[model samples]
Target: MKTKPNVLPAHNDCPQTTTTGNSRRRKAHRGIEMLSAMGWWSYAIIIVVCVLGMLFGLYIFGRSGSEASNLTQLATATQRAARTQAGFGTANLNTVLYNAGQIPNGWTYSSGTIYNQWNGTVTVTGKTSYFTITDTGIPSSECISIAQTLAAGGVANYLTVGGTKITPASDIATINTACGNANSSVNSTTKTIVMYVGALQ
Candidate 1:
């Protein structure tokens, strides 16, 4: 009776309260850690997407450059063949040129057919004083870019994008207009480019 002097039963609830508080704090900490992990994952995903986009862009740029180079090589070789070969104006100009080793490196030629970087058909047709180089399956934008560059450089006497003729003297506006016309086709996202380069003297 003397020991029970209103000691309040030793307050067993104090230990329970302390344990509950610690548990809540641990849950909050775990939540914070989970949020932090999610944020990191989001950032990682964004970085990966950006890297993939850049790589795709680079691939497109490199492919365009290669196409341009290939076209240039074909033009140069045609000019040289025109100057040296007596049969330059034949109906089978591509075969004749390829037989003479006029085809550019890396181009696939078999049975008189030439394939471009895009696996498109590349054909060479001849006239008396000029020859035509036609490449098919070009992307619309790349077709525009290549046509503009060749026109600006005065490399081709005349060229056609989607069958719209453009000359070396064609202004940027004119070229853009021609390309726009070709790009308006809903049936196809690709185009054909035909270049007419005069035979070298």
Candidate 2:
């Protein structure tokens, strides 16, 4: 009896997928994570923009007319102040000027030998200064336009006919510009700016 030997099937060598496949898998995972991070960052940016917009809106609305009520009350008090006010006494605004800040450049309180007595309805310009002055000491701490022309950008206290130093209820002081343009006032003396002191309009 001849017995034939059985041949075994050949096993072909195949490429193994371990490190390369793992690295590819890792890269794909990292790409997905990065996209997620980017999306979150975009959302964060949108939120920040919205918050900023709301804050700005609040600021604008808050500034609208909160000061009006206060000014009205102040006006009532000052208008009567003029009635009780006595005649003007002597006080060189210059003496008080130094107590204030430096006198503006190109604008001097106008050096004078005699102190200009602010009597009756005195204007704060020309003989005294080209800059006109309307006294809050007069009525309602009211700003009567100097009618000359100017905007200095500082404050001026009114030494009333009586003796009161009337301050504006609120513009901070009188502005030398005109109230016609925005909310401001001016004097007859051009370039002379008075402080604005009144509640915001």
Model 1 reaches what TM-score against the true structure?
0.81
Pairs with backbone N, CA or C atoms under 3 Å apart (clashes), candidate 1: none
| Model 2, span 1-201: residue lDDT tens | 988899665555555556988899999999999999999999999999999999986754432222122222222323222112331222333323323432322222443211111221212221222122333221221222321111121223321212223234423233322222323353222121232222222
What TM-score would every model get versus the actual structure? Answer: 0.81, 0.33
Q: How many Å off is the CA of 124 in candidate 2?
A: 15
Q: Runs in model 2 with CA error above 4 Å?
A: 1-17, 67-70, 76-201
Candidate 1 local Cα displacement, residue 173, angstroms: 4.8
Across 9-91, the per-residue lDDT of candidate 1 in tens digits comes to: 56665555358888999999999999999999999999999999999988877777778778888888877765445535646
Clashes of each: 0, 30
List all candidate RMSDs to the true structure. 3.8, 13.8
